[model samples]
Target: MTEDTLNSASIGAGALLSVLREGPARTRTELVELTGLARTTVSQRLDALLRHRWVVAADASTSSGGRPAATFAFNRAARLVLAADLGATHHRVAITDLGTTVLAERTADVPIDRGPESTLAWLAQTFTELLAESGYDLADVCGAGIGLPGPVEYLTGRPVNPPLMPGWDRFPVPEWLGERLGVPVLVDNDVNIMALGEHWGGHWGGHWAGYPEADQLIFVKIGTGIGCGIISDGRLHRGAQGAAGDIGHIRVAAADDEVVCHCGNTGCLEAFAGGAALAARITASGVLAKDSRDVVRLLGVGDPEVVHLVRQAGREIGDVLASIVNFFNPGAIVIGGDIAEAGEHLLAGVREVIYKRSLPLATRHLRIQASKLGDRAGVVGAAVMVIEHVLAPQAVDTTVTV
Candidate 1:
């Protein structure tokens, strides 16, 4: 079916499907109450969904009281989504059901510098293997979502002049992956998806709970690079050019530091506090750390130098973030990435600076801490991206017609 035909179809089915997918809708009466649809329209939409096995009937006895009305739930097994989290030094791929339940997942040390063609080819093969292991066929895939470690034009799913991702600038990621998987592909910056993952995983509770209340949040990833993801008014805030959270490139006011950034800038926040910077600092200090992971390992062994450097880096990051806090006034800030694994050292420095520098009003309600989902945030967020898009009202309408 053409896009025009799909859009022109009756929207009743989409509405019903969306409601049912969120949770079980017991009885036609309940669906009517929830969707505000007439009984006849509800019946028509239910029939269409049932015919396609997109929904299934639960035991009638499960319903409370009256004449045991039939209950229906979204058929999560009917389709799958492929989610990939591609970082600078590592990647993860997973196969998830329509409901975002991961069935199979694999992690590897694939570098993005291998370029899009090679990296995507590896992902394609890995996705096929993941599906096979999960006992699902490639035909069952409804869509795919990937998170790249750089700025991306969300609409086009293309990296835009990414500093660390050599040869990936303007790469047609969605087109390349979609053609290989034979499904719609969505892509976004890695940190953005990580924020989505953390938000969806209920990491924004306590200080505030759920959307809207927890909407004003910031996710800072201090890995090989430093970047942030902003959530405002219960939605991811990608700037007009999809660079809203490119905090790594922001110049810091540290007068004594003149470290050069990979983006060819001096004294940027990432140059002073990112994983690469820490690793380089450790190496230059006559330590044998190879990368950020090594620095973390040294920190684990109580190396005072590594500990001091990490804490200082945290302060540097927090110094930059203090301005962000004053500006955005986010309720929560989640810190993630390789260095975050060092635990309190990083958090202490960040908290110390943010609380001391930001205005009292902003700092009073702010809750800053380590990431809850940790390394899995990206993959889970990628899955969320696919699940959300595929289950949207318009997307469901198009799918039903197709």
Candidate 2:
């Protein structure tokens, strides 16, 4: 059913479902105690969820000394979501359950410059293949989330005059994909999803417990282009026009040589420190490096010049970030993308600059580190977006009917 056509339930039912989804399996009595709902209201909502198959009966709780009470659990397998992370030169797709458990995934070297029609067609075909391989049908998918390597008007799910994406300005991505997939679609900036992925415990072998105390975070991506994802007070901050963390376009005072950025700006941070800049510098030095990956390979082998350039780029990025730290006072800064593969050299440079420039109050509790999820961050974040949206109280009410 279409999102607009689905029936909705009372807010009380939605609230009850949310509690079951987040907490341990609970009986009717426990739900009443947690939600402050009357016993009859809890029973009514539970019956509605059971009718929609959004929740299922579980084994009785054995804690009470008398008769065991029947419990209910959120039915994670009742629906699925498709997630895609579209990069400048590569892309990844995955199928996940409602709980964000990935069942299948695939990566390919598809370029975004190929435009939306060609790239999205390939994505649809690949998704079909992935679902078949994983023994799931198209009807099982309730929604999809896509992350693009450009500025997006999140409300419309359309790219807004993206510099690197030609012929994609104002493309109706959600309508196009939703029509083909027969599910609602959500879209956002790639780095935004990466930040969400990192925060949702999708990093470090997919097992980070997350920092409960540090509610502010900055995720910087230093690849073919540069961007950042900002989280403030435990929520993604998209700003007034969904361009909150566009740090790459910010001018840096440390840039000595004039470099023209693709956005037709000179002395931009991306021009001085992004992957393309590093690749150009390396190729100009008689090295046949094709992209940032080659530069990372050189750095891995301890190439002194490559290492030096990467570290210098880190310092430049950190220079821009120090001002951000002073203004935002984020507790953590996570570096991601191909350039971050340089590891300690990059982190050391960033730490040095941030620690040296920022005030003591800002830097005192700051934690700077490399992204543990690497390239997987975007896809995982996309999955998380779909999961959160699909399970939200309003969305759940719309999707399920009693």
Candidate 3:
């Protein structure tokens, strides 16, 4: 073994704990091969990890004509995680173990506003009550993951000044939750988590999770407003301002040229295709006297105008998707939103326009469809935030030696 290759941190308890939290590891031989550590160094680290019960011995395996060596795996079940989704109109909290089993879950209707103080307090109280009722102690939790709408500075675990979500600018969501939850906290844009949850355990292959190729998968969200979560090369691409996937702000001329967005802009895609927009449009259409939900039922009954509005919304969204396709060249696109209940009529419009507008090469292999995860996508994404942070946490995990 090389003298300079050994690191003192390898012998420390914290480093050992970090490795175990990440996942299972092989014998010293395998760890050395994988981590580029010397065999003796790997042995020392594993020894510490084992003594602390952070890692446990698995079944022994035969090597090339040598004595059987026992494997080591993370004690995942020993730890639990807390996750939450602070939505626009409602909020939800869940506690789960490493196996992703839900031990406690609760929902609240705080309807987050410009400032987050009241909402944050409500979250803390709700979480406390739910955990107490479920018999899970806070100290036993390994971490907390929170998802919020709008752009977020993931490095700082804070939300940016998103126009729609006022009063939450620069709010340290993770730190606030961490103080209350008493564990490391991770915060991310809601759409990002939704993409994670939906894709990680998507229904594409039924019970078992399935994945499209990792090159490019776009998750388009149409809620009160619109947004998107982008995955490329198997990683989330948070932009310079941490708002890479804010697609709702994209300009779409379909709106009356003077139609101004809440962001004070004209012709935003959200102004036309968002759920709120759909509701307003349907209300104005007069043919559908009910509400947006009724529009879905009406469209199903072959109501001509309701069908046309749904198709038109899709086209507006597709126009924006066309630009996104040309720019990112995603392999597949998943549409998610409350109005998505409109079903195939909704997708048909998006596909028709995207195919017509996007460059042939860009749209040629692009598979456009609705997110199989549907309403569960956001919640699942919240859970995945905890998993990803625990696995390859950005601020704490990566290191380079001088």
Better of 2 and 3 by TM-score: 2
Instruction: Extract clashing residue pairs from model 3.
Output: 114-166, 114-167, 193-381
TM-score of predicted model 2? 0.94
Instruction: Estimate every model's Cα lDDT from 0 to 1.
Output: 0.84, 0.85, 0.73
Per-residue lDDT of candidate 3, residues 97-192 (tens digit): 764556778876566774688888787887778778987778777777778877889899888777768889898777776777778888888888
Task: Compare the candidates by TM-score and give the number of the best one.
Answer: 2
lDDT of 2 by residue, 166-219 (tens): 989999999998889898899999999999887775332343446543468899
Which 10 consecutive positions of candidate 3 have the poorest summed lDDT?
Answer: 393-402
Per-prediction TM-score to the true structure, in the order listed:
0.93, 0.94, 0.82
Residue 31, candidate 3: C-alpha displacement in angstroms = 4.0
Please give, for residues 91-203, the per-residue lDDT of candidate 1 as tens digits.
88988877666789999998899888999999999999998887787889888989999999998999999987999999998988888889999999999999988887764
lDDT of residue 206 for candidate 2: 41
Off by over 4 Å in 2: 1-11, 202-210
Instruction: Give the distance in Å from residue 11's predicted Cα in candidate 2 to where it truly belongs.
Output: 5.4
What are the runs in model 1 whose C-alpha is more than 4 Å off? 1-11, 61-65, 203-212, 255-257
Scored against the true structure, residue 147 in model 3 reaches a CA lDDT of: 82
